[model samples]
Target chain A: MADVPSMEALEALLRRLPGIGPRSAQRICYDLLVRKRNLLPQLATALERAHAAVRFCERCNNLSEAPLCAVCKGLHRDHSLLCIVESPADLRAIEDTGMFSGDYFVLMGHLSPLDGVGPEALHLDRLSERLAEADLQEVIFATNPTLEGEATAQFLADLVPAGITISRIAHGVPVGGELEYVDRGTLGRALHGRRLLDE
Target chain B: MADVPSMEALEALLRRLPGIGPRSAQRICYDLLVRKRNLLPQLATALERAHAAVRFCERCNNLSEAPLCAVCKGLHRDHSLLCIVESPADLRAIEDTGMFSGDYFVLMGHLSPLDGVGPEALHLDRLSERLAEADLQEVIFATNPTLEGEATAQFLADLVPAGITISRIAHGVPVGGELEYVDRGTLGRALHGRRLLDE
Candidate 1:
């Protein structure tokens, strides 16, 4: 047989996904063709459904079907304690920690000068509008500890009006991690941010 | 908002794919939703098309959209030399070697007693019919050197009638592999199958 046209098309599309290279994409495509006939239709339908039904939450910029995200709409969430994060994934991570009781503002990205991604790219105008409307007391910066993340957090801090308490998530060695294996930057950060023992 | 329904659906389907766990599926779903809007529809279409268009080649059991595989249809391929392999991927791998010009008979799987795979599972009936009809001089067993692969190869050898030459691909240390680091089984096989130097 000739090279299946549709198989090549599928491989090409799969290669465009995040973290999927050409070889893995080809393997995935082949697997789909050979062993996954039962699941192919379902996957296709799901992709289409998501593409059609999902949209950015107008309030928090998180994925939502409605105007506001789940956190934004939660009546019990602390409205006065708003946490800002770089992406929806980060918001999910903070949620999984179960320590935060506040609403979230998803920046969707950070300030990357080399990539030409700046405040405008992140739509800081929308954030400014949210801050003006909400009677928030504390604005927590939960952006990643990378250079771009720090720059974005600093920029957001400057954008916030006076009298609002600002905090950042701690950076240090991860839990269950050994000191010897920890990266130099993390070890340095851990040392610099050391706090006195509660006992 | 609250666990976007479409996003959840997409993630569930993605998790069904081989090698994709829940976390990576979630990550992929989020990336598709947030970053690859332009690609999502294309990917969906491609999957649907492949699902509809591709089928196993009837002659060789390789992936194809037509009645026969490329090698089976090629007049120049050595029809009298049929190579056997455990999967279509192995067939592709052998093709990549470019040393073999024969057509193939894809087993689709190795014989695994624990997994209930037998000669019936590999459809050796069709192979027997081919052997009776074709003027094949050599039938090469290129199954993996694992226990199941060896068992399958042994079974196939017993099935062939007398006077037909049955050969197996070599089991030895890989080219460029260090003897000190190579597994004992492979090293032993390499020594056992050593050929004399040319005069």
Candidate 2:
């Protein structure tokens, strides 16, 4: 049989996401074909547009289409306090709460030596340069409570020139609960209950 | 706070795909940024390449980069037996089994009256047009075993030309089991146990 090529292509693309398996990819492909095929080209366009146009805030490591992420560029944002997160998603999660007025620096991921990722792997150098400007007072380490996240926060704490006050986001998030799943209440409490990083 | 603008743009694009909610989309945006913000630009090219190039198969609704879908343009496929399905996902599901020999004609959707979807809405006219010239011997109606799906199958029974033998694939699937979730054995059983549509 001359197999349909598009199906295979879509399957391959969907498989690259975080949780999708072969069956999930197939289901998505099927759903797209039947229910959203007209949207396929648009979807492809959107996906490409997302990938092509978007970049990270050169300073904060947050996803951005421009040279700077919106938070880093916003004039009204609090430059005095900085919030550090593991991913752009973390930035959004904190943004959704509408409580934090501070700016963000997205680490994108934690340090993983197994993958050979080290200090150079993260934008820590850029962050050091940014913090050296002496305008910032407190830096909140809001990476997730995972071990990797903890390690990354610690590394950032050690690296940020010792002048800035660095703190982690509250960890009352039930163990094993990801920031992606945590409710605003728990997150807000955690944020309110933030402990100081003495180092 | 200078927010990252590019992240916002990427998030908007990711919001358009099926099943991806706000948080999920943000997570994807973050994942890309964290994994390697550089990869986002590469992914953009892939998306554009896919969108700019992918076209529907003239005969089947399968995605193609050409005027005709790969299956339709293929010389070796069994044009004599055309398999009818509700969506492209259905086609892929069937293909995953590696059993069927014939080409497919995707319906794009099932018949749903309450939602104002009828034969015309689903492009049954196109199917009729294809039937006029194709040397199709039999059409295997492989829609879901739902009320709407069964109705669609029955409706097509009258619409097909008298020379063609029409059969349904419901007997092979289990009751209350969606083809999307059914295992290979059950789906195979359902396909092998297909029943006549004349009643």
Candidate 3:
């Protein structure tokens, strides 16, 4: 059945979200419009609040309400170690592990030649300046292991000035993965990077 | 990384929607905040518009901006046939099939004793009044084929006054479903309602 104009507009906007298809969008629109009372107002208010408050971090380009992101502003986080990631979601994923205590630099996206997105588009010049200003001892490239991500990492590696250490996150079999189930490339990497127990 | 308060609030509201889990809600939040420029304003406007315009139809209880829903206001549709459904979504689903050209009555919900819902909660009194006023030839119970739906249908059948035909939608294996894959209840129903080839 055809939805009313406003419902149709809401559904259209919802469909633009990642992972939301036509059916789900329609359901969401109907839920907001009718099923759940007072939901639309809440959602609208939240959206407006976020739009008014959230902004990009001045240093890391991560999402923030203030000039600097929480990670950048936190006193205990390691300023000497910066983790470069493709998006804030990736940074959050790493943070969820509770293993990393370093600051971050969010690239927002990876370089893709087909999309005409290159170093200039990614603001590599600003990244270079940020690296020069910070007292960073190590920079970790935590971009996805996709081809475009690898190329972006390679480009950043080439751009690193002399003396400061640069590292890429290891690509190997998962911690609990069986060798038989792991892809050949990952298995090969795991074997190639094997270390002595004594060492 | 912890999201800012406004972003977190937006994500929370978004998660309340059907089919949106935490991950997709986060992605949608990020898309609205960063990926798509000016998305939040459009979504907010659409939501506000829908909230302001959409209202329950006075006659059939379906969503509409005006007093009467499109179906109730239509002159050409069968005024003598009224289909009763559990929700507006159900009404929309039936309309999409292009099979029924009758007016509708939305129950909004079925009788759930555990949830404190009953015939009164579903406005069965108003339904009786409407039925009395209309020159109805038939009343189709199009509620879902669940236990509660069945109970609700039964209650309505009992409520329907004499001299009016009452009907229920058939329940059996889905049109393209294989008998082997179909559930036992549906198979049983299909068998019980089997029709003659020439009839």
Candidate 4:
């Protein structure tokens, strides 16, 4: 069914967002009209500017406005250790932890041969080139513990040099989640990678 | 604890919504930075513009940019047989049904002595003035079924001339809502006012 104009366009725009449906879009549009008008333009500008200005970092494939993202350009991050992730969101997840001081190489997408996405489509060429030039001592394969992600990690392991150490992030019961709810596969993998804590 | 740059302000801006919470706001900000940067300015503009540009429709107190809203100024709608409603959303809800062809007179607030909202605050004087001059035949009291709404309806009923017929939209189980899920109070009212359909 065709919606009435003005609200129809705004509603369509809102529906394209992650969780918003048509009803929600309509409510959001009406709420916007009820509350804020001038701020709407600033929001619009930010949207256009951020989309147009942003690009994957040339070196690491993390999102950025410049040639390299903040993490890739930062002086403090260790170049010897590289954290590999699937997307910019994944990199942000790693950044939130604040436990790792190493630099990142965001893949932007995982290798999925079935979907016709191969090594060429991802930032694999840059990974190998970076491996050759940089004094990269270790590569931490922190891709999510999904089937595709595991296959991608295995595929990349074959491409990198033999000397550089490669490790995956701990696959275990989540810190706050109950053990009863944890899946058997994850529990088994966690048992396989058990480590002795100094504490 | 105090948030830096008032994350709470950002959080409040995001969380003032019906279902959004602090965590959801956090997620939304990240999501916006990630994928929805293109639409953020429009969102902000909608918010600011809605606040700055919109005002109460001088005739009905419905949200509008002009002294009189598009609904009030439209040449097509029946001007005399006014549909009295609780608020702007209520007006829109009636409009959405596509059953009502008459014009509207919105009561900005209902009568609530406990909350200190009274007849004077509700713009009843304006409504009364309009009633005196209006060539009105009927006034549909489309206020909510709540206690305050009933009280407001009673107050309006007192002021309305003896010649004008007053009516209310039937209430009951909503189109998709289960009778079991419907409040006993609302269900009773709906059944009491149920019409005998030809079908």
Cα deviation of A107 in candidate 3 (Å)? 1.3
**lDDT minimum window of 10 residues, candidate 1 chain B:** B126-135
Candidate 3 on B1-199: residue-level lDDT in tens? 4649899998888889999999989888877777885989888888989999888999888888788888888878987888999998888889889899988999999999989997788988789887886578899999999999999999889878789999999988898878899989889999998889998
Comparing only chain A of model 3 with the true chain A, what is the TM-score?
A: 0.91
Span of ten consecutive residues with least summed lDDT in model 3 chain B: B28-37
Model 3, A121-194: lDDT tens digits are 77787788868855888889999999999999998988777888999998888988787899998889888988
Quantify all predictions' global Cα lDDT against the true fold. 0.85, 0.72, 0.86, 0.73
- Give the per-residue lDDT of model 4 (tens digit) for B53-140: 5677888777666778778777788766888887777888888888888888888768889988878887878898777756788888
Tens-digit per-residue lDDT, B136-183, candidate 1: 888899999899999999988987778879999988888888888999
TM-score of candidate 4 against the unseen true structure: 0.75
Q: Ten residues in a row with the worst lDDT in model 4 chain B?
A: B1-10
Model 2 has a clash total of 29
Evaluation by DockQ, superior candidate among 2 and 4: 2
Tens-digit lDDT string for candidate 2 (A71-185): 7778798888888887777787788789999877777678988888887867777777777766889989987877788888887888776667877765567778799999887
For B23-65, candidate 2 gives per-residue lDDT tens digits of: 7776676666555455555554444454456556777887666
Place model 1 in a CAPRI quality band.
medium
**Stretches > 4 Å off in candidate 1:** none
TM-score for candidate 1, please give it. 0.95
Candidate 1 lDDT, A63-176, residue by residue in tens: 888777888888889888889999988898899888999888999999998998867888788888867755789899999999989989998998887888899899999999
User: DockQ of every model listed?
Assistant: 0.70, 0.26, 0.69, 0.24
Q: Runs in model 3 with CA error above 4 Å?
A: A1-3, A176-181, A197-199, B1-3
